[model samples]
Target: MRVSIKDIALKCNLSVSTVSRALNGDYGVKSATRTSVMKVAKELGYVPNIAAKELVSQKSKLIGIILNESDGDGEARPAFFELLPHINKTLAIFNYRAIIYTINSNSYIRGEITDIINLRNLSGCIVVSVFRENHPIYEDIKSLNNPIVVLESSILTRICSNINTDEVMGGYMATRYLIDNGHKQIGFVNGPQNFEISNERFEGFQKAIEESQLQISDTAIIWSNYTGSGGKDSIHQLIQNNPAITAVFFANDLMAMGAISSMAESGILVPKDISIIGYDGLFVCKYYNPPLASVVIDNAAIGVRAAELLLELINGGSGKTVRVMPKLFEGKSVRKY
Candidate 1:
């Protein structure tokens, strides 16, 4: 048989109201009474009724982890996976639980997110990997009274906080690294335009080129999906259009690896024929043939920080933005020109 607060109260010979107040840690309850109620509750094997507590408190203890549906099929960025454990661990510190919700990237509409929040009675959400600026979901999230924290793309509200790496600086660092090695004829392979990070990185790339007085032909820059296959195709297109380019900077590690493999199939050697640098600083980069140079974002730090910010919002804190700095990881992929 299960034990209830009433059983504990009966065993302690206290009023039900006093027992409840002690169990809930309410102010004005005497410390001695609280300790006595806790001891009796433990002796009786009393368990908390979270659902009932939630009803009375008017807030759930559930935290939603929202991801794009494409992430399941390996079409989205891998950084989110790295972020998950940290977020989960941080939430556990506050006795909160996390639930993941994957929504279709192209098909999800307004009110769908709100519907999910209502159905689950979630206290807060951490949205990851959806980068489109004017999407219907963004509008819905903006109007929601519940707290939300977004990763990467910006969508600020009174209840929403945004967190991202300084992508422009990351892009600049990648480009500047290549330029410092005496490679002037460089190409850039970026992700699709709908993502704000893509544009920010591109801006950094352009800044490096202009400052160095180097010229990049229109044909040397290609915007493609952030996938391995997309990387392979972009490499072929880039090489075909600008055969004189001595180096390339990929916006992500997957594409850089894909391009490397594709180049090998065509009897072209990396660093020997062309140098490369990538972003995201994935773990696999260290093990790849010739290794890969990349701009590293501290995924674990970002995850922990995002979780902390969201919990603050849940507790009636004001919304704010946070941008983490990126560091460069050098590898054998970039050959000095």
Candidate 2:
């Protein structure tokens, strides 16, 4: 005994097609007729079948959130997790629901994105994944007709928009903080060089170093994966290679925490012996034994902007790029001279 549009149509003494058009607010239906149909629908307790409605309208109010599987340790996507609630909240305002689609980097290389979008009838998408510049996924995305918002990556398609943190400024802020605090012999621990973020951060670090009339040794910089364990090894190597180094900037907070634990194990105290700073302003940074200073990326802001940009594209706006600035969070991990 389920209520349907047919029940409302019969009660309103109107044809099914007229009732359907009235319910959807389609043109050619008078305002009074639409109101009467809705009132009759309410009286009959008519419930809509979403799939049937979508099939008739040919527009699914579904948004896709595409994520690339993490490279290692499965904890690399903390920022994406943080963005989920904000993105969903914003999309809900427009009566759209978000559907998550997880795929490997190789899937993009194999060009599986089209199938995923078409199969779900997604009206738009926000991609929260990282891929190298030469990856075939960039070309695959360009050929797509749907609105796409890419986070932490760039694609030069008319239908695609890019959003990311001001990475160069973030790198400069972290390194400059150390230099201003009387630490000249500084070291930098970065993520894999293949990542654009890693290279941009390196550029920022170099900008600060050169501006201060300082020269960094060849061994002062180390590139590693964005993992806690990678941090432990990088800090150990940095200390051994440059005993004169008094401070270091880690590309992410997880690595900074790992480096802290390794230093604790080796009886090398923080701040008293060396200072440390990090990027990505993770929540755990403020609660560590010695709070860690960091450059924070606002994931919530990025999420809202991404959703708005997708809507703009759906409404016929051209694709554009947006960059969120980073904020510096001071903690006890850095000591002033």
Candidate 3:
């Protein structure tokens, strides 16, 4: 049986109007009366009707989580899986709900995103995708009045804020570790050049090489999609063209794991013939035969910060960008010279 406000009002010997105001935290209800109503409502296990509340308040209290399928081939990576639950839990604490919306990079046209938000009546939204500066969605995003938070991209609008792991730092940390181990002939397997993260990480890689005074050949760098197969292809190309390469850095763990198998198939032993390290400290890395070394991006922190920022924006706060630092997880994948 559902417990309604009418039942509580009757028990309290009060009118329905008085009970409604108190239940909704509206002004004019005495503290004692509000407390009594809440206590009785809890005892009766009352669940507020969200539709009714929204109708009365003219607010949806619903948040949209928009993700772009950048890889468009339908192979979705679980990169944001850990981060989303945290965001949902944080929003729930404030009586808000999260709805997921996916956009395909290949199919998404201009103004499509704006239509989703307006039609869904979302109070605000968080976007997680790999978008180049020239992506058409930015025009739609910039014109929105609602609050928005974007993860892992450089796009920022007056109403849109950004949250990301410190990609440059993560890249530098991974590469410097290889350098410290005395690997001079290092190769880099990065993601598609269109993604901002791929470029930022490469910047860090360049910084580390410059600081170490190591001269890396132009042929040593390769770009691919953030997929296992892409990693395998890139590593094979990187090594076959630059056989002097003694170690390599992958922009993601999936690619790193793929490269390991590719090397084994080619009769090259990891850390013995060629050393390697990866990014994205996925838990599965520790279980690998050689244990992958990676820079851990704290997705939990990003989720919490993103939720907070969205709430802040809904409440009329100004938008701002936030960056969480990545930590290095050392493993046995790299060999010391």
Candidate 4:
């Protein structure tokens, strides 16, 4: 009961071969004839056989999207989740479908990534995960022929194409924001080792410290996971190390919430005895008891842009790097000093 190209050909009074060429916009067909065929095809609501087209073109019209989960946890930062909707939005405009490749792996093996990528007949791939400066997988990806766009990678010289936010600047912004408000004894909670974003943000913290000429002894910094529980633990350690510390800057909002709750349990009030600032402008931050001040990074934009960048490589975009910057949000948590 459905319509076919042959049926359209018969209705248009054209040979089947000619109709096929016109529908495909083949070189031999005249523009006028092609337009006429397309007109009829539209009027008939003709849906071309995509499988047949793939056979002829040998292209899947599918792009590979790699989700590189960091921190060895199933939890993806709220910003990373934001990127997914934007990537889907951008791909919709290009008529290209995404083939998700999960890199929720802790092995850090090149073969794992290579095997997963080859399993799908993808025209191109976009790698989204937090990797360090000397990861072996970077070399392996560079050896492959497929176009790749890596997200949140700091080492641009080795990779073909990459897109990431200015994390160091983000770190600097968060720390400086605290410093600008006249808080001299500022405390900082650091993230785990080897993740590039952590290091960059750490550098930014140092930059602010350097500019202020503030002496941050070893006791002022406590390294921990970017989770709320980690933040809660780090606060105890930080306070134990430097009891006089009056303000704290948590690398992520999860830790900030933990610190806020723990402080309240012990008869401490935010910005009264201590001020707190956090990162990742998640929507949930707005509802906190004393709304959290944070660094606003557009995770959705990163996701969407990363997708578009991969598409360009598939359809013929030159290799290049993209960067996004983070901004600050002034919430109720920070008190004016």
Candidate 5:
């Protein structure tokens, strides 16, 4: 019951080849003829078959991806869950399909990326792994002919496009907010060691603390993996080291949530006993018993922009290094100190 290009051509009384070329916006089709073909195509409700088009074009029309898949049934991070849809939706706009290549952190091996990419015939690739420094795939990634876009904080390789926020600025903003809030004993809960985002954010935190001349104890800064268990486990060590700390800036929202929950379980109330501000503005933050204040980056925007950059690279363009800024969202968790 669907209308076809042949139907449009028949109605317009034009050759099938001429109708096809005009519909595709190919050269050699007259403007008047192209317009007529479109008018007829629209009238007939003719939809271009993407699958058929791709077959003829001899391109996969599929965007390849590498995402971290947990080995166990542990909960996924909020960032990955939210980011997947935005990437798919953005790719849909360009009539492209997304093909996920999930990998466990331990399973990533050298030359594996190249093998899969070539086998899939991917038009381009996006690496969504939340990485630590010197990601293992660096060399193999460089050897691929396909374009790559990484969500890493640094330009780890020459061939890939990297997109990340100014984590240092984010850290600065959070710390300065605490200082301006009349809280002198501000604490910081950092992410795992060697994470570029975590290090940058910590650097910014240090800058603000030094500028404010605020006293910081070794116990006040906690190093945590960007996970709930990590956050929960880290807080006791921190509080035992610096019992007088008032406000804490968490590197990511997930850890913040865990810290707050752990604090509550230990009979401490948020903002009353301590104030917490988290990075990564997840939607679930709003529903927290007391909404969590956070630094919100445009993760959705980052995904789309990375896709755009990769597509450009696929079309013979060079990758450019870019950084996006984040904004602070004031939620109910932070009290006026």
Candidate 6:
């Protein structure tokens, strides 16, 4: 019941090879012929057999979307979810499809990534939310023969590309903003110490305080998980230990929101009792009781750029690195002193 390329060739009164070339938009096919073939193929309701195409070309058109299981129960980060649509749209332009694979972080060992690629015959991959630095998976991905683009983690190879936001500058901007507003006793709530972004941001925070000649107290910094509950717990612990702190910088928006909610329950108000700044520039920040001030990363741009880089790699291009800059989104949460 399905129309085939042969059927189109028969209707157009052309050789099967000529029809194939025209349908594929291959070189040597005249523009008029290609247009005619496409129009006729559309009239006949022809659907491409991707499986057959793969068999003939010996290359799958499938692009693997890899995520770490540790990011939480198969659901990707909010930032990653924001990036997905752009990545998918870009891939569709190249006639490629995305297939998601959640790598188990807890039980992962070396060589598993290579096995997955071989089994799927994937044309390329986009890895997201992998936090560990020296994990076996990184080593495996480095040695893979196929093209790959990693988000947030830096792993460069002949076949792989890396992309991330400029986290150090983001951190510095957030801290310096607080310092400029006259908040001398500032606290910093960071994610886990193992994450490279966390360390970079902390360095930025330290730089801002040092430049301002403000004392850095050990009790003013807390390293916690990148979760709302973790943020709530961290704020309470931070305030209890350093009651003189007049402002805080949270590494992410979720934690910042959690801290705000927790502080509200304790009769403390943001920008009134204490000022706050957050990272990740989540859209929901605009709707919060007091709009959140954050360092916003361009998720859409990152997604599109990642897709373009992966396509280039798949087409035999060499690896490269891309770092996007972050912008400060001023909101009502930060009170000007």
The C-alpha lDDT values of all candidates are 0.88, 0.86, 0.86, 0.78, 0.80, 0.87
Of the pair 1 and 2, which is ahead by TM-score?
Answer: 1
Write candidate 6's Cα lDDT for 18-128 as tens digits. Answer: 998677544345778888989999999998886788899776878889988776334346787888899999887656788888788778977877777788898889997
> Candidate 3 or 4, higher lDDT?
3
Model 2: weakest 10-residue lDDT segment is 70-79
Q: Roughly what TM-score does model 2 have, to 2 decimal places? A: 0.85
Stretches of model 2 off by over 4 angstroms after superposition? 1-49, 106-108
Clashes of each: 0, 0, 0, 0, 0, 0
TM-score for each of the candidates: 0.87, 0.85, 0.87, 0.83, 0.84, 0.87
Residue pairs in candidate 6 whose N, alpha carbon or C atoms collide under 3 angstroms: none
Give me the runs in candidate 1 sitting further than 4 Å from their true place.
1-47, 71-76
**Cα lDDT, model 4, residue 166:** 83
What does candidate 6 score on TM?
0.87
Candidate number with the higher lDDT (1 or 4): 1
lDDT of 2: 0.86
Error of 2 at 251 (Å): 0.9
lDDT of 3 by residue, 1-337 (tens): 8888899999999999888877765434677998898899999999998788888767677888888765624556667787889999888766678999888767788888888887878888998766666678877888888889988876677678999999999999999999999999999999888888999999999999999999999899998888889888899899889988999999999899988998898898887888889998987888986999999888888899999888878766778889999999888899898
- Residues 57-164 of candidate 1 have per-residue lDDT tens digits of 876778999988864246766788788999998887666789999888678877998999989899899997755767778888889999999987778888999999
Count of clashing pairs, candidate 5? 0
Worst 10 residues of 1 by lDDT: 69-78
lDDT of 1 at 20: 87
